[model samples]
Target: MVPVRDELFARLERFYDAIPRDGAHTEAFGGLVLFVRDGAGWPFYARPRLDATEPASAADVADVRRRQRELGLPEAFEWVHENNPELLAVARSAGLSVLEAPLMVLDPTALPSVTELSDVPVRLLDPAAPTFGADLAARRAVAAVGFAAPGTAVGGAGPAARDTALVELPLDALAEEQCRTESGHRISALAELPGQGAVASGMAMRVDDAAEIAGIATLPSARRRGLGAAITAALARRLLADGVDLVFLSAGSTEIARVYLRVGFRRVGTACIAEPA
Candidate 1:
């Protein structure tokens, strides 16, 4: 039987598989898949967020802990999102704490007007900048207080530091985009499936339902001008044309949620995060 929220996640899983994975770090723990960019020490960590079949118990925690040790992931980086209350209990038992998170969506058709983007321009970046270094540091000062924040909080922190750490790790091939003002300052940026000249996506080890929308951010000076909404819509449109039906992304606030809702995406559910202290 199809579990509740499975279709949404199934779409994500399929998208994940569709993309190439030759440039990022990956670790499999149980049935959970954790992906990280090599250049950014540890800014983003993605796994299949879903409800658990069995209640998280001591044994489950122990098993996860063992998996972590074997995979070399920091205990602090471990997290879980599930509708099963028992799963939350299991995470607590394993020293993880839950944070309130909301999943937001938007329909591509309803996306607001972006013609106001006269001052700001978005362009694809070449030799894609490392995700966890200078590019990320550039936004911390401007990012929203608790929301629209990437790095560290949701793992998109320290562009330089994380990028260095990811230098040697095996990472999936990546594509990058930057939100820049007319003055030539990049305010926000994003990384998606690399669109390098003719590379086989299957060789990229792309997961079947996982097209990770990584490092989405906008600069302080570029806010309120519809840059974010425009870029997001552009990405969504591209993906849909490429034959992707559903896209998955996590939001840090209602404001960001509003932008997404204006676009054509609908919420399937919440993606809760539990981090180890």
Candidate 2:
């Protein structure tokens, strides 16, 4: 396992702070913190201060739960570091289920040389642009299909259900929220396949000095053709050019991790997402 650097972790902390949790509630107690973003449709866990001057206690866990109830969020929803077994135990004792994945980071010096695909055109979509609404809808459609494909993270959802949920998403509101804060910036892009509107799509968000690369998906018919890699590399390069140096993402699986590794990312630590059981 590549040791997680303190600076990288600090960046992660800031990135969390920079997220635009519009119309959300936040509470902090000792080593624990929680955010309830209604628009996000999920609650998020702030990095636990397990290593703070005072260790996390049962009181903190109780307080976090209390806040969750107040916000009407699910009984449990947290993003925690796997290294903190103490925190994980507390959440588990509270009846939360945990799913862990690798936290990967890209070091500028190790960026791989990814050749741009000439035949496939990849371009960034500006959220504020006039055509953003239609483009975003198309991108979300592609994402829903990608996520429902066999072997993907959100796989069990059949295409029809996935498409329905995605199509109903408030893309306009999401676009507005992504750009409302100075700390947040979202870049959406797509790879056009011959005769297909878009076969591959992804997005990256830069919050202050740190960035997260997410939603990289290629349609089933477009897999193994490097479209995913191309989109990821393009987004990363754009973020780097924009002056946000610390870039990271959570890989859903080892195969996906391998895809990211080709673009200079290395597994640094384990990231765990826990939700009500």
Candidate 3:
């Protein structure tokens, strides 16, 4: 039988291509492809497909940078696999910073039994529910705190600075967007703490028949209590039950990756995010 990873990788590539651009233009230069949405709340980046050739030339890098500048978007590139050393070298030489994360996929046959942590009830939020407004506030608060915590991969700022920025976001709108099941995503959170609100939360985005689990976090005060794993497992189980063929996520670190591994997620490939130098 063929490797499951190859099939999943292909599905991922198709998923990226199918992302509704909402009128944004996409152009391909050799093996590199760029998506430009004019900063319309959609991702704008250059990416190399899994079957791309080696030795991404300096000219290719320059062309990508030129297009990004013309669109007035920051220069960013994403390499979905580790097979692009040549492209990565070209990107880095041109002053693009890189962050590498391990891509992980869940093995349904190996899934561990879901065990809810005591006193930490995990709740799936319904965007249409009467209490959605309050629940959304609590969910956003937990996310702000979790992402701002020291050593988080996404937030590079100090806690105070990150908190200030996160609080200013249009969270009401965000909550509305995330809670819409018709929008192909779902949000879940752990029970509220006495003063900290929701202590753990995560969301899943459906791409074709596969689901990408993202934004999983546990507040600092709730760390080490298995709340993170509990929420993750719960989300995975629900997605599988809903007929999602594949579920994957990019772990922020080996420590975080280990958490998913305990729940049957296997290492599949490397995921890279490149930003302007």
Candidate 3 wrongly placed segments (more than 4 Å): 1-3, 20-25, 38-42, 49-56, 70-72, 82-85, 113-119, 137-141, 150-180, 186-191
**Candidate closer to the true structure by TM-score (higher is better), 2 or 3:** 2
> Would you give me the overall lDDT of model 2?
0.68
Q: What TM-score goes with each of the models?
A: 0.55, 0.79, 0.78
| Cα distance off (Å), candidate 3, residue 36 | 3.2
- What is the number of residue pairs that collide in model 2? 0
**lDDT per model, in order?**
0.42, 0.68, 0.68
- Tens digits of per-residue lDDT, candidate 3, 12-104, equal 766655553433577777677787774335356777744456556667777888988887877888767545656677777888887778888
Clashes within 3 Å, all models in order: 53, 0, 0
After TM-score superposition, the amount by which residue 212's alpha carbon in candidate 2 deviates from its true location, in angstroms, is 0.8
Ten residues in sequence with the least summed lDDT for candidate 2: 150-159
Give the C-alpha lDDT of model 1: 0.42
Off by over 4 Å in 2: 1-4, 21-23, 38-53, 57-59, 62-70, 80-85, 113-119, 150-184
- Per-residue lDDT of 175 in model 2: 49
Checking candidate 3 for backbone clashes, the offending pairs are none
